[model samples]
Target: MRSVEKVGKTVNDAVTEALIELGASTEEVDIEIITKGSKGLLGFGARDAKVRVTLKAPAEVEPQIEVISEVKEDVKVANANKETETVAPPKSSKVKNKEKKDSEDAVVVTRDELAHVQALAEEFLYKLLREMNIEATVKSEVVNNNRLSIGFEGKSMGVVIGKRGETLDAIQYIVNIVANKGRTEYVKIMLDTENYRARREETLKKLAYKLSKKAQQSKKPIILEPMNPYDRRIIHSALQDSKIVKTHSEGKEPFRRVVITPNYQNKSYR
Candidate 1:
């Protein structure tokens, strides 16, 4: 889906674009502002905001098929690029230079739109934390993967992260739900404190691989301690196709963890 958050006017340009493409009137589409913009510090911290919209129409009366076709074309292009990278070798200087140029060219951005998204995320994050009786300042920025990176600062950031960041993950999930409620476009939100989440994810991946090896050698199940949902998801995803071991998540939210078991039936834990 395409997104627009540019400045110069308080209007729904994206809705107009969607309506034009859908061959439908504005009334046929449903529009909602998922988040509000922010203005801070005497116009120095002023930026635009965003809204997510969804359009509905009768099955036979939908928009032109070209839109969907374009999305498919994009998917094909991405897959083709992936295959080329894996099969092609960087043997020639020309190839290497081209690859570097391509990488540099990939970062497409409209500065106004980016600033708007960051403002919206920061505003929503601050309000959410405040309602939870936690005093914190939420600041966000657009990062890779069309994701928003939110950072919490203040004396209570430690409280926000909680033990092993289980509470912090819950906070992030709530922020995502609240932020995306009644929205059409999907925006990924990542919350962290001092880069703790990234560091922890790397650590968990290492631990998952290490445990998989141990299970392979001992032919036994390795049950890990309870972890937050995100960490458990990481472990499960990391060992998805491990030939020597299988991974599964056990327990409920806030206490879930991944268990690695040998491929063959051996010692079991109940």
Candidate 2:
């Protein structure tokens, strides 16, 4: 058996040398390209490129003892045969892992859709806020469940929020229809001023508890000030678990109010 010789050299100029020494064509040898090679740093550091080459006989000489030993060791732990069976070399001219419609797991929104939403919202918000004399700039924005959340950053966006964020809620409702005009699935628009909706939701929860206790104690149905439908819904939702009281909305649209009442069946309150 002819002893197979192994060669190693810096990757920068190793391919031709390896092929010549092994009496093999460039296509017969596997070339592995590695990134992040030794780079000189501050003109003081330099990296040495490296490559490994395995030489084979031109006439298919019998394997040497050392090569046989190494092959047996590789088979014992690496299952080299199994690894080769599992991984396949690329066959087509295209790159591997390219995006495929059905194979892709991520939700993809086209550039046209994103651009349409952004441009439409920007124009609408600019006009709406400018008309109200509230100078505000659109900040972060996102599309969720087909809805657009346009965050505004400006001096005292509290004006947009209005009393209990009624103005913001009304604006969002109207924008939702206009923004999603002629769409099969209407996108809900949310105009948030510095995350006002989240903060207001917390405040409403606290208010619900306070009103529930007050109504329970007074034994009278408290007709709170009229709020937007969303706000009324929030109040009702917040008191869903209260055993001492119940909440319901009264009136319509812009005049809707959340009324808290003591459990009517409680004879003491009645």
Candidate 3:
């Protein structure tokens, strides 16, 4: 883990300074406020707040596939050292195995199509970022079944994420269109800059819980400010199973928002 110490007018200011230096979100760091500086006599004797922030270390990658070559070498040595002849499997069983292999190859993502989508996604995103005058390295990975994840690594996350990921969503929409155009099966594309989506989802989840509590206390509908469809979905999913409140989306696209209201059906019946 890497750590830093900063001084600012307030604790929040000091923490923000550390986060920028670390290029991390609030959830990714451990913060310690060494001193909560106070104002003393009209900014003359006022002391600046001091803080220590530590970032979590990245996870190590798992073991990998270079073992295949060693296995091949062992097989070659075994065949060379064998003194007895080996018998082949029956023709019928070989046919069955061939059929099984063909079936396995016919999954939702074909090898060729996966490669094509990965290339297209990376190129499209790189070009788009260049057009926006942002220097970013976009890498593509094939994930799950026929899904392409385009990950961005750069310092412009705040701009790319926008006020609430509106810009990111807009960019993903266009990238999806470019990737799936004229393709037979849709290859789902997810664009993220350094776990931004995961962090945003968590933030929205907490917001849902807080707003639900407010709605429960007041017994009044709480209309959240406007959000994009992606954010609205997060709110709805977060409160879908809440016992105290119900959630719904209202208004139209781009301006749509989530409404959280207290559940009153059982209360009314009682």
Candidate 4:
């Protein structure tokens, strides 16, 4: 594999410099952080971050060719044998038409159906808030004709948001269930307050980057705190393009956590 080392003010900068030198995308290389540079007090002991980027070996295409050759050889042998065998007859036109119709019958939400789901979600959310004695106005919007985004507004929204938006997530889950009951096409429901969901997503993305850097620097796996599937997805997506670290989740729901590990093979680095 071809490799190059570069230095910059930060890890991202160093990785970018190395990528430019190697003319490779993130998916085509494995990156190792040699040093996570620091900004010392008063710029007296400042240091630059250093990274080594190695281009990954090209994938072998010979195995696929071999498999195809084996299949062809089997076919040739079968033809040579010329043994009498029972063959199943082709399906009737009615059977084929029925199969096609079954496939085409897949449920799709129309504009009216989307509006119905939106109203149902909004109504359920409002009633739930009232029962909790949290005075908040529910606003709903349709997204992509199959998703509903519900927003809560009012001074008492902090209660609705709850700790880390757990309460909001639970409410959204229930609202989706209620809205999709007796419906063939499922509609997704998203609930948020004070832009909490968006803000939390941003925070998770930043944390993903920081932990990725730490994983590369320490050359070890970093297990993050437990997060819901939604938050876990945010972390995964944030580092999906990174060549230095890879992210995955483990454990069951409600306790599942994101794990960040350095993406490198068992090889010595210069």
Candidate 5:
């Protein structure tokens, strides 16, 4: 990701200038505050605020496909050799339970219903944006036959994406409620502006790695600032495979935080 540094009257101004240079939004880049400028008395020692903004890396899809292809090849080889084997191993209980749960959770909806829900979600979003006096284009897509992904494009998205995306999340929550008001089978609705969701996920993953290293080096628990449940999940998943540290969340909603602790029992950490 490319990064740029800018100086302005305040941190927000510096970040805004940086974003304008990158042609990106606040959600699309990670901002680091370098200095909070001060307005000196009589303007003798005034200093401008400086900030560094870095564009986030794009999502990786090719690597996942390669991994899946390798797994399929292994499965094909196993199937080809099955005839010569005297016996085959049974599926694990975990696998069986998972399959059963998936079957029970699967809900079939007609094409008409899908279209209706999509239109409903889009209409509600348009009205909401109109009421907020923000003009933006709304696009919706069906993902995995069960989720609706909506994207927005326009100016002043920082208002829609409030601090840490609280505003965006609240919008999504209301949309979901309106869309599934009387439906027996619920469809998930996800909202994004300027690719905020993806960019935020990338930032959280990077933070997880950094904090994990800090915990391991210091041999102490590192508590992150409060994050929503969605963000906390990203942190936990990012560090789930680490050999030097473990992660978990503590506290109540809106104030819950993730804590990364060094795994002292692990030889690598010791």
Candidate 6:
């Protein structure tokens, strides 16, 4: 039996590393924790967690042959000088078009479908806020197509908005799930309080313009801080008309960011 010590930011990470290195399953190894690492401030003097893994000893086995009944066989020709034919199934254009429509319906939400979903969403949110002891008037935006944008206006809306609109985002997430439930297609839902979304969009647009100018003037790329998908879309939309700059998103969720670069106007873009 061989043992290996691995270090990582956590005991689980260390165990993962050890398993990968030894190419063993969890059931095949015994793990020992060395240290529970500390998440130190600002990445200074951080102690990583450690684990020791030992491979389990193999069990001794006795080999025995089990007998299967044998039968005499009449041998047949093995496709020697034989001709084979495959018949193709008849194809219907209508069937293919119906399948394509089904797939598209699953992915694309229609305006009428969103209207119904948004109505349910608004009722759900109004009830939710009332239950929370925060009496708010919830209304759906009338202008949007294939998307639900709910507007909340209340006498006391500060608690609903929370710090940096975190609560609002949480509420929006729940309401989005409510809106899309039992639907075959996606219906995006957005919640706004005190026009927070519009304000946020304006801020992102300004930041995009500023960064675009900076990148163009300095001939360097600028990476913005990670934002949610909606905010990232706002940044891209803001820069869509920029003749001198372009935007791209990189990294994974929660840590994904927007990178801005100067376009130099000589290159064509879509």
Instruction: Write down the TM-score of every candidate.
Output: 0.47, 0.49, 0.57, 0.58, 0.63, 0.53
Q: Please, what are the lDDT tens digits per residue for candidate 3 over residues 1-270?
A: 899998866676677557546654444568899999999897689988999989765443222235334433544564576621122234544575578666644558788998988888788888888888899888777776567878888887778876346678889999899988898788888899979899878877777787678567655566565555666677776666566776655555544555565677637423
lDDT of 2 by residue, 1-270 (tens): 112222222352344334334443332345454432465777466654445545444454332335434433543444433421111123321232343323332444555665676677778888988888888788536553244668888886877876446578778777777776776544445678887888767776776777678567655555555555566667776776566776655444544455565676667655
Per-residue C-alpha lDDT of model 6 across residues 1-270, encoded as one tens digit per residue: 889999866676577557545654454578899998988899887898999988887542111111101100100121232321111122443465568666644556666786789788988898889888998888887433556667888877878876446689999888888878887666777788898778767776776776677567555456555566777787776776566766666556655666665564535422
lDDT of each: 0.58, 0.56, 0.69, 0.68, 0.72, 0.66
For each of the candidates, the C-alpha root-mean-square deviation to the true structure, in angstroms, is: 20.5, 32.4, 23.5, 17.2, 15.2, 20.5
Runs in model 1 lying further than 4 Å from the true structure: 1-117, 128-137, 241-243, 250-257, 264-270
lDDT for 15 in candidate 1 is: 41
> By the lDDT metric, which is better: model 3 or model 4?
3
Provide the lDDT at 130 for model 5: 97
What's the candidate order when arranged by decreasing lDDT? 5, 3, 4, 6, 1, 2
The true-versus-predicted C-alpha distance at residue 11 of model 2, in Å, is: 83
Off-target runs (Cα >4 Å) in candidate 5 are: 1-105
Which residue ranges in model 2 land beyond 4 Å of their true spot? 1-115, 127-135, 143-145, 163-166, 252-255, 264-270
Which candidate has the top score in TM-score?
A: 5
lDDT tens readout by residue for model 4, 35-149: 9999999988999899898988766211232433453354355446652111112234346556756654444679999888888888887788889988888888877555677
The residue-level lDDT of candidate 4 at 216 comes to 73
Clashing pairs in 6: none
- Please report the TM-score between candidate 3 and the true structure: 0.57
What global local distance difference test value does model 1 have? Answer: 0.58
Off by over 4 Å in 6: 1-119, 141-146, 264-270
Clashing pairs in 2: 10-49, 38-47
What stretches of model 3 exceed 4 Å from their correct place? 1-107, 266-270
Clashes of 4: 0
lDDT of 6 at 10: 65
Q: Please give, for residues 209-251, the per-residue lDDT of candidate 5 as tens digits.
A: 8667756765656655556678877877676667787665555
Which scores higher on TM-score, 3 or 6? 3
